[model samples]
Target: MDLNVTLVLIGVDIPRSGLLRSGYPDPRTGQWVFSPAKTAKSFNPSAVTQTERRFDLVDLAPFDYDSAEGMTAFVQHLAGIEGRLRLLRARPGMLTEGEMPEYLFRRTHGIVGLLKRLIEDGCTEAMESGAEELTPELLSTIQINLGNLDDRDPTAGEIPEVPHNVPVPARKARKKDRNSVFDDRGGSVAGG
Candidate 1:
């Protein structure tokens, strides 16, 4: 019998040690050791071989928080989806009206997870308080934690304040210097 298999490992910050190491094989066993702590006594024979290809994932760019269009669309989409806003009362143009978008962006800092939590909590609050619409006043009362600390303490690290009416500044263009090695005798090359 013959079998084929493919192993896939995914993570945000995968350590170079342990099974991921591409070190020299042990002289006695001729096997790669997977000890991350570098202790002589600790040895794991299940280390990954150097033949395996490693691909690093590029970090995703943050969402555009300066503009409310993206946040507004996300909220609208979330509400329109089935099983999402079933309990909340139907209100025409409820999410996209007035200061709701700005308020939401300010609270969530354009983070999708935070925004979702805020919306879900706001919906629950609306149902309980008989206020079907999501208002700035209603959302302000709903305290959102950073989710890094313990949930038991409601007064833990709150979401960082995002200033209103302040747009994200544009990134400055990087200046490129002419390669001195390839430069001509006429001072320096005009372009690369």
Candidate 2:
């Protein structure tokens, strides 16, 4: 048998629209009919309405995963953030502006502008250096590291030779002009 003392100690917060066991008499039968007892109407509405609050925490749920793609994307995002932060927190000496022959006074103006331009120049230089280092071998190595350079794939085989004698489809070449409008059927659309 269930004990009543244990159940009584736990005060259950049941949402009651009216008093429990409350009833009304049937009009025709004169029998007592019961319904869920709703609490007496209050000055307040049923639901509490308030302004939406902002969640301060960063949502990293999408980046948190056991999958290789998710991990790679997360790592790439971190790397990008690191790069940007490094640039943002860079010292004036790190940029080429320090090498400039101009001497600054104690109350020099436009120093912030000079620093901004120097940072831009440094970013351009870094981009140029990265572009110069890009090669097919580096790309192949990256692909290999990512487990994408599979030799077993048919399309990944040696490049096929192109045939000199091939029939080209006879179709009118459409001109891509800013003022021109073309529809899906290759017909000129009537509009500005």
TM-score of each: 0.44, 0.19
Tens-digit lDDT string for candidate 2 (50-77): 1111111111122433566754554454
Q: For candidate 1, lDDT tens digit of each residue in 30-139?
A: 54443343334436433333323233223232346455776556556544632345545656555555555556666766666677777788778988999876767777
Candidate 1 regions with alpha-carbon error over 4 angstroms? 1-61, 67-83, 146-192
lDDT comparing candidate 1 with the true structure: 0.54
Residue pairs in clash, model 1: none
Residue 93 lDDT, candidate 2, scale 0-100 = 34
Worst 10 residues of 2 by lDDT: 50-59
lDDT (Cα atoms) of all candidates against the true structure: 0.54, 0.32
- Native-to-model Cα distance after best TM-score fit, residue 91 in candidate 2, in Å: 15
